[model samples]
Target: MFSLADLPDTIPIFPLPGALLLPRARLPLHIFEPRYLAMLDDCLKTQHRLIGMVQPQEGSAMSAGRLHGIGCAGRVTQFSETEDGRYMITLTGISRFRFSRDVTGFSPYVKAEVSWPDFQRDLGGEEEDPDFDREVFLKLLSRYFEVAGLETDWSNLEEADDELLINSLSMLCPFAVEEKQALLEAPQLVDRRQTLTALMDFTCRGGSSAPDELLQ
Candidate 1:
């Protein structure tokens, strides 16, 4: 297990319902709200201005919002302050964090003390499978795309690594709140991919059927 002591002190915290971040990928955030602005200020002053991206259970602002247990910490690699005092920030994920507890007495954004797991990444092993399972996933994803009438760069998507592909799709896909939470709480890349595959299959089948196969 990865220790909390190893994490950088004073990490950045982004608290929003239904948003998830995964490691080794980048997420762009538009920051205009006051609490997040205050968070940006606090991060800029610290040595490790890294931020943990988490989803709150309740759809409220800082007050009365409950954070989910899992999150990913990212470093602000690129940032631009807009003319209107808004910030367009790019967060590049560093590691996945499990919430140890929440830190209070700060601004609107809630900070969590976290612990991480020891994971080894094999960056060169990405591949496209033409088997039945992969075919089903692809077909489901296509249906999802058509249903939502969304356009994406298929070529670039086909080239993404497993973690990036699954997590990015999970974040952007029009899935339910519980479904998104499931994707966020999945322990590893393999498990997450499997869960996503199941979700896609169910969605493609057009059923709100119980996720019996997946939950098992």
Candidate 2:
């Protein structure tokens, strides 16, 4: 069994993969799944059900439903109940966590004790990447859209901040699973930016010659 001895006593957790929540980000979630609904209810009652967003491993029965080791913890900041019995909620990321242990409890969702060592932004922190080329990113993204024949709202794209722009594109770009995992596990914003540039370049080139390969 895993242990929680080294982790913080209280932390809200949402263990969902394919969802990456970063600080200062507002992720809109459609909460219709029952297990996750229970998790939301628990969070509503507690006022801070921290969620650790991570991806599930591929082809591993033992780790099938469990989360990976690394994730970001998001707090349930805004919530409303929809007429369809679904929840329209927004999560504001607080910290990045490492799963130390999974708590066996009555809750349908698994809880992991986590540590937030790299949560804060500082001089040496991952947030210190200053050379992000927004103009270059936008040009490449525009070319990518044309090559793929995609329709998007460029107005919204223009106003997004660095994190939102990068993470949003990363989230929706239809990249490979392993590629998405690499983006998620990228240690710094600067590194993520670099990866985004490289991926965009690949998409632009491969998209023109072989659309299938670009998508793959």
Candidate 3:
């Protein structure tokens, strides 16, 4: 369990469209840009070692882009710096937060005041979601993979626990920004599962009326 006290009142955000992180999920990031490299340095020096992973809104201007309001905060766990000054870091997520507003002038990197009430449940370990529709999820996933011509280690996927399987697939799947936001904002694990189902169904069927799956 993460202590709320360890998190800062505000967090510096790294906004890369299509990249995402979720509570308890680990995301590998390449930090080559000067601003983010500086951000990583400050994190290593200060105890405020959490970075908020967010996405710039699709089709938005890169120079002065708008970000999706919700993002997950990740704690720096693995870090290594290359001779060329680039940093390869892995962030293990701590919790999800909603942006209150952007606050600037404190750092070269962008900063945002954020609130965590929506994701307090994330501080605790994820319990097995009784309502998870594993059969449907797998069926749609298999079909989606077939459509995309993507391959997976089926044996490894089968061995994953409920939380790992869901989070892993959600991260790996190339769902649209709106769909990804739906997964992040789901109120509970079961809800996220349902949202994943909807997104997968839409993607696999070319955004037609959602294809129905056998319910068990």
Q: What would the TM-scores of all predictions be?
A: 0.80, 0.78, 0.90
Q: List, residue by residue over 1-216, the lDDT tens digit for candidate 1.
A: 223455663355677666666666678999999888988888878766688887666454543246666677877888999899999998876676667776776466776667664432312233333232545566677887876578799887777655567778877776655677777667666677777877877766775632855543
Model 1 TM-score? 0.80
**Residue-wise lDDT of candidate 2 within 1-216, one digit each (tens)?**
112232354554564445666655557788897877887887677634566676665433323255567676667788899888899988876666677777777877666676766544411222545787778879989988787678789999989877778877777776654466666667678777777677767777773222232223
Q: Which digits, one per residue and each the tens of the lDDT, describe model 3 over residues 154-184?
A: 9898888898888887777876665666677
Better of 2 and 3 by TM-score: 3
Please state the error at residue 189 of candidate 3 in Å: 0.9
lDDT, residue 153, model 2: 97
| Candidate 1 clashes between residue pairs 3 or more apart in a chain or in different chains | 12-50, 12-51
Worst 10 residues of 3 by lDDT: 207-216
Could you arrange the candidates by TM-score from highest to lowest?
3, 1, 2
- Model 2 segments beyond 4 Å from truth? 1-17, 59-66, 122-128, 207-216
Give lDDT for model 1. 0.68
lDDT of each candidate versus the true structure: 0.68, 0.65, 0.79
List the candidates ranked by lDDT, beginning with the highest. 3, 1, 2
